[model samples]
Target: MIDGWYWKFIGVGLIIYSMIVGMLVPLKPSIELVAPSAAKTGQQINLEVTGYNTNYSGSASIRAWLKDEEGNAVLSKNVTVINAQNLVANFDIPGFLPSSDRVVPFTLILDHPVDGAMVSPDAVFITQDSISKVEGQTLWQKDIINDLTLNTAFTFPSMSLIRETIRNTFYHVPLWFAMVIIFGAAVYWSIKYLRNPQSYQYDNRAVGFTSVGILFGILGTVTGALWARFVWGSYWSWDIKQIVTAVALLIYMAYFILRNAIEDDDRKGRVAAVYNIFAFVALIPLIFVVPRMMDSLHPGNGGNPGLGANDLDNSMRMIFYPAIIGWIIIGLWLANVRYRLLDIKYNLMNK
Candidate 1:
């Protein structure tokens, strides 16, 4: 006999822990060079570079160099750090060099007090008019080594479109996961009620779980819309996944309307139980299957992979997994409370 209070405490603790961890971590410094992929001989090339987490406000050294296949440095240039994360580098292409279609690789190196020495190898591509080969050369070694230490605070991944809204992953995604778990439990109790129509307890339990599941589903929709508003530039994108989820929720909504339309206890239990099973069945294809078959903006739709290397990384997985578990526990706690209340009300009515 596990008490409901146990789940309540656990759910609250996990939720709070996830919130703290999801917001505090910092990202490692990364560099992106905006240099041209091709340059002509006797041309002056200027490279624009952007940095993340580079601690650009302080004094930092930035350098770039072009390397040949033989690991010899063909051209070395000093980068002028405009700010912590921004820099400009200039290179002069020699007119005497021969032309080749092959691409030349360049490297960007940043040295910061806070982030230490960050090196981005083969960071840029340049198709120059030079076919001159440097042989018997060795690779250039980094002057500064990185100190791989973890920060105490939690940080979310800084994606291009999502930006800070990536934090919503801890909240929005978990609601749907929790809703699925809660609705699955409702389907189980509905099956139990159908097996023994006389047992009002199963009917009450099914109704309670369904009610809470629907609530979670509605919350999921609202949070998803809020997340979309920031990323997609609208609250609703008419995306296939979004539309299908709305239709599925509406189907579950009809389940409650059907339950209320009935007056007799036994008949109502039998009918609602049947409807609940059908609703869950319909939900499967609408939310999971249909979205995958069509083109959609949502991640994992139309054969697109969910949480790729660029999306959810190892740091995010740390909190995301716990968030799903925490919300599921919380949803169960809500359903259990609702069940007990309905039980008490019905017992009183019998007296």
Candidate 2:
């Protein structure tokens, strides 16, 4: 039986642990902003760098460089650490850009012994009259960027655009995962009820699973919307994933409405069971397959790399995978409680 208090304790404990780890842990040091984003060739430039989770003033051995797609780079002539999270980097722009393009953006890389290395891609664009690759090679290659030390900070990955919202991964993703599993269990019980038409217990269990799954689905949608607002600048962007997920949830909701429409216990159980099974079937394509086929800015969909990529590295996995496990356990426990309540209601109504 899943009624034991021990399982509840374990599930709640893991969930609390996951929440603490997910919220408390910091992201890796990063160059959050580089002001004066453009410069002309042969001009002296001093750009302000606003860093995130960095300690620029703590170390005097700081180095900065601007690099392009090619192997060439221009090292900063002066670096002034204004504070823990702000710095000024000055560079004497080379006479020519290293790239073949007339305009090319350069990445800013900053390294410190205490904070390790942090970068801002396409931080500054330098426009030149010509490519002058050969001449650039002579000028840009003078300062080697090999003196950098690897970052050993224990933190989450600093994803671009996503930034701090990347922490939402632990909650939002795991909730969806748990929802799918709970829905699968609901479908399983529905199948069992269809096989044994005489058992109201299976019907109650199916209802419990469906209700909890719907709750999970709602939470997942809310969390995802909050995450989307950070990266995409809106709560509802009419993205395919959002639309399809809403439709899928609505269809499951109709299942409960269908159950309410029928008053007879045997008939209600049979109809709801059949509808639950069908809803699960529809959910598969709506949530998984259709999202992959369309163009979406949603991470992990439409050929976009999911959490399995660099976004969810070993450090996050410590909180991420455990969160998934904890959510699933809690979902099951909730479903079990819901079914017991339904069973009690069934007995009370008959008595």
Q: For this target, which candidate reaches the highest lDDT against the unseen true structure?
A: 2
Model 2 error, position 180 (Å): 0.3
Off by over 4 Å in 1: 31-42, 57-59, 65-76, 93-155
Please give the distance, in angstroms, between residue 41's alpha carbon in candidate 1 and its true position after superposition: 5.9
> Can you give the TM-score per candidate against the true fold?
0.78, 0.96
lDDT (C-alpha, whole model) for all candidates: 0.72, 0.87
Highest TM-score scorer: 2
In lDDT terms, how accurate is model 1?
0.72
- Tens-place lDDT per residue, model 1, 1-351, is 146377778888888888988777666555544555556545677767677666555654444555444443434455576876777767665543322445666554445555554456665565644454331122233232244333333455555556567788888889888988889999999999999887888888899889988998899889889888888789998988789889999999998899889998789999999999999999987887777777777765345523445668778889988999999888888888888888898899889
Candidate 2 residue-wise lDDT, 1-351, digit = tens:
454588777778888988998898888888888999999999999989999888899999799999988758888999999999999999999998766688889999998997788888999989998678788778888458877878876888886788888888888999989999999999999999999988788999999999999999999999888888878999999988889989999999999999999999899999999999899999998888887777887776335523436567888889888888899999989899899999899899989
Model 1: pairs clashing at backbone N, Cα or C within 3 Å: 24-154, 25-153, 25-154, 25-155, 56-84
Question: Which TM-score value belongs to model 1?
Answer: 0.78
